[model samples]
Target: MALCVMMFLLVIPASLAQEDMDDKVFLFPKDKHTDHVSLTPNITKPLEKFSVCLYFFRDFLRNLNLFSLASPGTGNTFYFADSSSTNTVHMNQDSALFRTNMEPYEWKHACVTWNSDTGVVKLWVNGKLYPRRVCMKGSSIPAETSMVLGQKQDSFEKKSTTYPFVGEISDVHMWDYVLTPEEMLQALNKNAHGNIINWNSLLYEIKGDILVLPKSRCPYQITSKSYVDNGEDVDNGEDVDNGEDVDNGEDVDNGEDVDNGEDVDNGEDVDNGEDVDNGEDVDNGEDVDNGQGCL
Candidate 1:
């Protein structure tokens, strides 16, 4: 009996527990109809107000399903999609379209919040909050639902083949209440996490062709920054200031060299008494008549 129990425990998947998914991403390589990620949240009660946020990097501008939450009757209980011209957030089958310019093949951060009491919905993209709109006025999302990424879930059915996401997605989170502006900023910076679906301790199962991989970030970091009286080389991938501050390739002190033919100390090279100010050679206060002008 003991051996059997141990074997059964070993066969159980890690998705059954909270996972630390920080600094990781879900990569949907292609538009496979069955490819999706099923997320499990800890909420067992209906939510009157909620917020969802994620970061996505895509190359194509076609129909893309960012997040989907489906209940018994409403497939789009809370769905978010993106296109070239606009981003739409749905609540209980009703959606609000937010028109904004989206850049292709770049990482974009999006956050959506909805309150059933007021039916007001707000969308923020890359830390900029857009105009608010209202949807699903008094309806709350049922707790018995299916949440997914990469494709939309229709009443627990994965049927978003045409609108499958094609790129990388990371830092997916959801809260039971609408986050304030300061809280949202903290979420964008990874300083805050969701209580309902925390990305740091997420519980998820990968299906089909989805890839769980580490996120792309710069490996090198600047440890410290300081201004030195003596010349020092800073190779931390940042600009360095030498003894004389150079602005736009021009010396600030004006006593240093300039490439635009501005001479030092009135064209005298190093104050050595060489008459190079006017580019004409004269012998020590003696003017040579070069036939163009005579003394």
Candidate 2:
């Protein structure tokens, strides 16, 4: 997962102390979707005009949250997926025009801008400008923003979380004012600094098991029902032996045997033992092999 975020066009020179840590890769474990990074508030006076930018990547459409901004009464929810679309860009308590198509498993840049002067909000994906939306006109977001990332918050101070993002994210940046197309293009091409949350000097805290990778090679293994092989839905999280693809309905219901194999039943009780997983046999489902191997 790589999120390449940039800010204003003018790249300000910073001290050696203000650089992104070489530790760029932060891996959130699949088992711990509740994990998140809580950022200290950006105490920059009037929270009127601002934009949140980042790069993200994932392979599933499972209601992943990208960011949130909550005020006293009104708030905005930025998310990736909903019940409607797989790759969506949605906002809350706003208007009707807020949706975009974002592909998965590839790095893509996204930015959302809100201006209180005109109560206009806009979103940009890659380099395209989406339609401007009307919301919170002439009003500033609460100075004390209940900001959150990688999870959806339904209330201020992040009181409720209904959706948690499961993927890799990076290069987060926030700007106090909207960036011009030229500035946006410059930031997209060159390096820039964030008035607020700079990826280079990011201030954040991690919760739960989030693997921070300093290298490009990943060592974690994931085995699940969604694993696909050459357009075949053959893997339902079951084990395979000696490079042999054995899931062809050979061990259930009919108890029929077409060839020599293990776990083949003959209507007579055959309780095959639990299958080995991660070097351990984990029992699941009912073992009715009459006297068979697995129950």
Candidate 3:
């Protein structure tokens, strides 16, 4: 009877577990619609670290402008810029191309990993580590920025713009800590097949065209590219006219004047033996041979 009771207890809980799993809801965006999947409020811890992985395929004729996985807040943000003007990635914040140029019909499978304590951010574009430099130090994230996918939050406008994403997004995943490179690759493979592996007993799954995972910290690598530096106008040093710095306002010696026997002395007609007022001809009929004659 004791053995029978033990089996009954185990079976009851297993059945309940199956039921609970079945009850979990998976939501996905409608097909052929540009729907954004926003994270719930309070999904991230106040100051912990986190990371996110997204698999997307571009379909537009032009490459997209900016691809971002930014948390809703003032400080925490991560995005990839197509600054090269050639579909290559760049991290410069000041590149005009960054804001104006967009590559069409290019797909991306990218990941951003962030650590709040260290303030280090890393970006992986198609499993390759893209180069960048960080400027923003780790800081507490503001509570107002809403986590968004596929579009940029124009804070000044105070509304979500219709520059909606035009592509297929799947296998979105998030973790509370930085993922190792190997783990990231594995995740990518699993995502391609619409599968998620169990990590730390956390259940991960791709539900149709949407992904739902437990929120941890904001998963963004603080870019090594310093926005502060970007704001500073680069002074290539003024194009000071070549001879403007000479002490006596001397004409620049290009060697041609010396070889061609041209007058180098402020155009003063020495041959006439008098300062030709305002460069007018002072034909001193004698033709005094001053050796320095006008060509």
Tens-place lDDT per residue, model 1, 122-189, is 99998899999999898888888889888887666555666888888889999999999999999877
Stretches of candidate 2 exceeding 4 Å from the true structure? 1-19, 31-33, 72-92, 95-97, 215-295
lDDT digits (tens) for residues 104-175 of candidate 2 = 554556777777788777777776787877776776665666666676556665534566666666667788
Report the candidate with higher lDDT, 1 versus 2.
1
Candidate models: Cα lDDT each = 0.74, 0.55, 0.40
RMSD of 1: 16.2
Model 3: per-residue Cα lDDT over 1-295, one tens digit each? 9999998787543312211122122233333234444432234244345566665544454443233334443311434333323332222131111122323333355666656566566667667765533423455444343444454444411224434455444455566567788887876564322112122222332212553422222112122321212132111232222232311245553543321354536433322222322343222322121111110
Worst window of 10 by summed lDDT in candidate 3: 286-295
> What would you estimate as the lDDT of candidate 1?
0.74
Best by TM-score: 1
- What are the runs in model 3 whose C-alpha is more than 4 Å off? 1-35, 41-44, 61-107, 142-145, 156-159, 191-295
Q: Report how far off residue 181 is in candidate 3 (Å).
A: 1.1
